[model samples]
Target: LSSSMYEQIFDRTVSVKQRDREVSSFQLTYWINWHRNRHAPVRVLIREF
Candidate 1:
């Protein structure tokens, strides 16, 4: 029973880390897209003028 409990705890910790990694990756992609979009309009306007 103690071993099983330990395993469960370990599994929960691993899942939490996995979730954190996924969230960070999602944030990174979002940041990159925002950065690109922020500059895209300026570039377009410069080209037009």
Candidate 2:
């Protein structure tokens, strides 16, 4: 999804950092319960205006 400048979207400001670690993370998933389905996993890319 496309978003606008901070003036329009930001209510506050903050910074975040991740710690380096060696770990095996497991993925949890479930199937759709409805009729419609995804053809494949969703994809993202750099948006050019």
Candidate 3:
């Protein structure tokens, strides 16, 4: 998928995850941690490429 598509999916998924956790105060932390973890699969895909 295109980068924008990836971003949309990521944003939606992150929002859902944050909602599930109900940690509005720690949103920045959750975003950072979730973002870090989310890149793992892309890294693997890059390596494969």
Candidate 4:
């Protein structure tokens, strides 16, 4: 996804997450494997990897 999309996700998710006590910080991780020729996989940062 583009940086613009990432920015939106960052803003929206943070507010929703604040309602819960389990969350600490926020992070966005992505990987592009063109060899697979499929969509990228994104993992939202949780307490663990």
Highest lDDT against the true fold, candidate: 3
Candidate 3 colliding pairs: none
Give candidate 4's whole-model lDDT: 0.41
Model 3 Cα RMSD, 1 decimal: 8.7
- Superposed by TM-score, candidate 1 places the C-alpha of residue 2 at a distance from the truth, in angstroms, of 0.9
TM-scores of the models, in the order given = 0.39, 0.13, 0.45, 0.38
Give model 1's TM-score versus the native structure: 0.39
The residue-by-residue lDDT of candidate 2 on 1-49, one tens digit each, is 1233431222121111112233212211121111013222122111100
Tens digits of per-residue lDDT for model 4, 1-49: 6755754565465556565676554322221223113332234333213
Q: lDDT (CA) for every model shown?
A: 0.48, 0.19, 0.57, 0.41
Give the best candidate by TM-score.
Answer: 3
lDDT of 1 by residue, 1-49 (tens): 3644544554464356456756675664564356346443334223322
Scored against the true structure, residue 46 in model 4 reaches a CA lDDT of 33
* Count of backbone collisions in candidate 3: 0
Ranking by TM-score: 3, 1, 4, 2
Q: Which regions of candidate 1 fall more than 4 Å away from where they truly are?
A: 22-49
Please tell me which model should have the higher lDDT, number 2 or number 4: 4
- Please state the error at residue 36 of candidate 3 in Å: 4.6
In model 3, what is the error at residue 15, expressed in angstroms?
0.1
Could you tally the backbone clashes for each prediction? 0, 0, 0, 0
Model 3: per-residue lDDT, tens digit, 1-49? 6666766676666567656856564774666556657563454334322
